[model samples]
Target: MSRIGKQPVALPDGVTASVSGQTIEVKGPKATKSFTATDDVTLEVQDGVVVVTPRGKSKRARQQWGMTRTIVANLVHGAKDVFKKELEIRGVGYRAQMQGNTLKLNLGYSHDVDFDVPEGVTVTAPKPTELVVEGTDKQLVGQVAANIRDWRRPEPYKGKGIRYKGEYIFQKEGKKK
Candidate 1:
């Protein structure tokens, strides 16, 4: 049995969930999100809660049980509130600023990197070195932050580059005799 699947996801006040076949849709004040579970798992909304159960005793079914439950929980949470990811830019002259819907990054490159902000997600630069990504969809918010960080991943030698807030980059010794 899956411990996580055993626990139903509660629907908070102002949040509602509905199930149709294998798909579950959650609606809240912030947003409405829907997810379709695989055939190995079943989705149901009952008594102000969402429940997920496996259709069979197979290993795949067992695996999908927990995964499906978590997905449903994420949908509910995302519908009710926004998800956020923060990034930090380290190194001299490296900075970021928002230009309309685009994020302009200066990561020590000869030319500035222009990142087009996709719909449904908002990228804000509170400071030159700080960036905050927010969206109703958790995956999209995290992916946008990762893409921004990929332009200048921290190097072990100088530990200078774009990185997630609180992320530690393991440093290596410099050239020695």
Candidate 2:
């Protein structure tokens, strides 16, 4: 039995969910999101909750069962509330700013790195060294943050780079004398 798959996803007061074949649509004040599960799983809305079940006892069906349920839950949560990811620039010269729809970054590179913000996600530079990514889709928000961090991943030498907020970097000993 799949623990997560067995749990019903409850719809909040202002949120509504609809089921059509393999697709489930969740609508809320913030946004509306839909997900289509594989044929190995079934989707249904009962009362104020959404349930997912396996179509068969096969291993693939069982795997899809839990994954489908979690996807539906994410749709519900995303429809009702936005997801956010924060990043911090740690190097001395590293910084970030928003120019129109682009994010201009100075990550100790010869040329400033220009990151074009996608349509669904919004990137904001609250401070010179702080960046906040927000969107209705959790995956998009996280992916954008990760892409920004990839430019200058935190290193152990001096921990100089871009990193998620509150992320810890284990510093290694400097070159032996």
Candidate 3:
């Protein structure tokens, strides 16, 4: 038996989980997430807890069972608690602002970069340099944040660019005169 797969996932208050065929749906107060299990994996809900089991005894089945369970658990947690990513714009003139559903970034470039925020995600700028990304889906939120940060990634020379809050960029010493 797989260790992670054998463990039961406890459903939090105000969260609901349902299994139908190969699909699992998790509904929470904030949002809902759905996942489809592999052919060799089976999901069961017992006494408000979710259990994942493999259909047959095989190495591949064993490997997939635990992975599927963890993915489902993440989906449940994400729907309830959500996920967030914070970014900081460095440099003198670099800044970010929210214009309707789009994020406008001024990263010392002649033209401002505009990014359209996808559905199911929210972006907020508490400060001109600070950006907060929130969404129920962890993968989507992270990808969006990475895309934004890629516009002007922090450099090792001067470290003037966009980066995650609290992230450090190592500075290199200049050549001796």
Off by over 4 Å in 3: 1-3
Error of 3 at 11 (Å): 0.7
| Top candidate (TM-score) | 2
| Candidate 1 lDDT by residue in tens digits, 1-177 | 999999999999999998888888899999999998999998888899888989989999999999999888888899889999999999999999999999999988789999999999999999999999999998899899999989999999999999999999999999999
Model 2 over residues 1-177: C-alpha lDDT tens digits? 999999999999899998888888899999989888899999989999998989989999999999998888888899889999989898887889999999999988899999999988999898999999999998889898999999989999999999899999999999997
TM-score of 3: 0.91
- Top-down TM-score ranking: 2, 1, 3
Judged by lDDT relative to the true structure, which candidate is superior, 1 or 3?
1
Candidate 3: tens digits of C-alpha lDDT, residues 68-105: 98888888889689889999998999999999999999
Candidate 1 Cα errors over 4 Å, as ranges: none
Screening candidate 2 with a backbone cut-off below 3 angstroms (N, C-alpha, C), the clashing residue pairs are none
**Residue 69 displacement in candidate 1 (angstroms):** 0.9
